[model samples]
Target: MKSQEVIFVGTRSGLRLVLDAEENIENLKRVLERRLQEAVGFYSGARVTVETRGAVVAPEWIEEVRSVLAHHGLSMDERGWDGASAGSADGGASAGREPEAPPDGAGQDQSLPGADTVLIRRSLRSGQSVSFDGNIVVMGDVNPGSEVCAAGDIVVFGALRGVAYAGANGSADARVIALRLTPTQLRIADKITRSPDDEVQAPSGPEMAYLRDGAIVIEPWTTHLGAVFGV
Candidate 1:
């Protein structure tokens, strides 16, 4: 396979593997393994989707790719099975379905066994993105057009104006917290929501967004709420 045989694009949903059309199956595996090995630890725990350059990808080939991804601790997203492209080479949105209502007080404890927490000390600019297997804590703003995704919760000490996806691995209990809660889009697990289109009042204080009654809801972050996320 050539160097351009496989392309990796990060988006609000997760990571996408855009494969070239007419790629030799064996060569495809080799390139995929090599690329994944190069970023070994960084890609673990991220949900992945595969897309071809307008070619019909066989199920067996997809499963082979899935096996390779699993070896690297990544799982495949089924949405791409129908050959729907998640994003272009630059990356964009591929929204998931809204989740059913979760039980009361779900995800309140917000603890994950053996899940590592990554701290990003710098703000994320447009066209930048970060994805992790566990939780994420960003010390600065997430500017518009940027994205932050984790399999667990996300806590931003500054503004979140871009896209933020918590529980990217299907954990509906995950929450997103920011000093300024506005965002282009917000996703928790399989559920998705966005900021209202109408003008809104300024954020009075820190805010938290989470799944409630099968929809995403935002509330003021209080002193007690800090204990829930262990901030």
Candidate 2:
């Protein structure tokens, strides 16, 4: 089995995925499919960048690779091609280039009706803070001392060790979901809760926190509650 690793390359648009050059294309596709399967909710409507670090390749190969990604509803942006000369046969100098930003107000938000969902693909280290007006879905861990606040729900694919506040704008229906729910402080709407000092050590699993009666209550996530919770 091939171990999948994620490398972040910060850019103007957003973070880019740096795929290993040595890995075969099949393995790359498999890794991407697995990641999508694991975090379907996070990637449902997210835009991603698939970056490379070599000269531009054949157009057919690029199209084929892109088709594979499209099957999973993932968009791709090619970048990092500085080796080929201007007149090289590798399809001109603009083969693998970053896309220019859209014109002002072309794609900007305009009082959208649906709530925005921010998908974070990297870990939140100590001292890092994320604040958004809508829901937040983090695909990585939230380390201690970090803070995440959203006006809607909060979903952490990994461990939650920091402080998280869902429904910060007073939406009592918002909830917090995490794979490992041992947070220093957790809040839903106006209710707040903290992990007990003598916390019981147990296997980590999916859990959810929501407002119950007048207080926040945590419970294990189950598929059977899908209809009741409207999840």
Candidate 3:
């Protein structure tokens, strides 16, 4: 089944699940397993919150659900019941602690290199703007007039003829990579560069753009270079 086939049940506030099927407990588990196998990489390391409907669910049932999810590497959290809340167990607000937001100006976690990356397996069309405060990886083409901006780096597995900005949060070390390096405008940190007005031959293989001598330069994606010097 496709990703859209998964249903998100909102029985109560703040708890939801992407369920593959809705039926008996055994059937639900089987559906979930099948879905997980279809897209294992996409769901890996993802934290999911689940909310039980108004049903008076026992702790054992919850535990069984948790076990099934955990087997597929899914983490779950429940929405606490409080006073007068419609989904509250005792018709009262949940006594659970409130959730905290990420720190202000954190933009994205640059310290944890892997945590900052986003993987998109879909093509980006015109009028689409993807802004991430960290690294971004697109396994599809970035069509013209579309924009992809990141504070860290950008890796496009397909053609890139749109606007792309890397190192948006003043990261001069950030880079922009793509299979076809043709863009309306490219920026790294504080510097900006654009394709020449004259049509140039497009490179067939992957290419990377980084800072060089206070400017942005595009280079072939090869391993011959020891280290990139000067930014």
Candidate 4:
């Protein structure tokens, strides 16, 4: 199989296998199975996300991919399966349904773990996205043109250049964190804000993005910041 035909990306969120849109699903599965066997144990017990973002495969074929992954010791963990996300992969939006609404006074306890959390270990490239109904932790950067949206807090251990929306379910209390907090756009619940256009670059240490009053604010990330937000 060609390298781009079936690519596997490792993220803190788990191992994401992105299948090319043009490839035949049957051929894709066979190619994937062979590749998995060759790289045995590389993705053991890892929760997997199949990215057919722009692919034509229907809901049933995704099951085939899942089965193929299961054959290679990889399967989606039930705990990490956000209710809103399943076979749908278009920027984390669920297929044919509206995102569920959060409870009243939702942001009161952002750390309550009311939903599932997903981790991606690598930086997101252009046009790639990850969405979930719970917290999302990306171990790498989120490059420009990519996006990460979550119903809860979003934590990127690396830079965030594209866009990120936290509290997607409408919790103004949701937060965004990154080693470099410069985002083209930052969103919390229903509000939206962009990074300053000043010449000053991002600070040396980590930064936190949260809602202060009616605007989004970025502050130096510290050990106790989570406590301040009840996260």
Report, for every candidate in turn, its global Cα lDDT versus the true structure.
0.75, 0.63, 0.62, 0.69
Task: Give the 10-residue window scoring lowest on summed lDDT in candidate 4.
Answer: 98-107
- Summarize candidate 2's per-residue lDDT along 28-135 as a digit string, tens digits: 667766765774433332234544433344566456556765776655544322222222344232323432332122224422211689999999999998977678
lDDT of 4 by residue, 35-100 (tens): 888865445444555554433455576677778888876775432223223434543333223223
Please give, for residues 1-231, the per-residue lDDT of candidate 1 as tens digits. Answer: 549888776543446677765789999899999999997445667767666654555668888889999999888867555433324222212222211211112223323511689999999999999987788999999999999988878999999999998877666778999999999999887678888899999798999998888799998999897787575
Sorted on TM-score, highest at the top, how do the candidates line up? 1, 4, 2, 3
What is the TM-score of candidate 2? 0.51
Q: Backbone collision count in every prediction?
A: 0, 0, 9, 9
TM-score of 3: 0.50
3 versus 4: better TM-score goes to: 4
RMSD of each: 13.1, 15.5, 14.2, 13.2
Give TM per candidate: 0.56, 0.51, 0.50, 0.51
The residue-level lDDT of candidate 3 at 83 comes to 20
lDDT, candidate 3, 58-156, per-residue tens? 566567767877887656644321121244453221322222221112213215322478998998999997877578999999999998887678999
The most accurate candidate by TM-score is 1
Error of 3 at 60 (Å): 50
Model 4 alpha-carbon drift over 4 Å, by segment: 1-114
In terms of lDDT, the poorest run of 10 residues in model 1 is 95-104
Q: What TM-score quantifies how close candidate 4 is to the native fold?
A: 0.51
* Candidates 1 and 3, the one with greater TM-score: 1
Off by over 4 Å in 2: 1-114
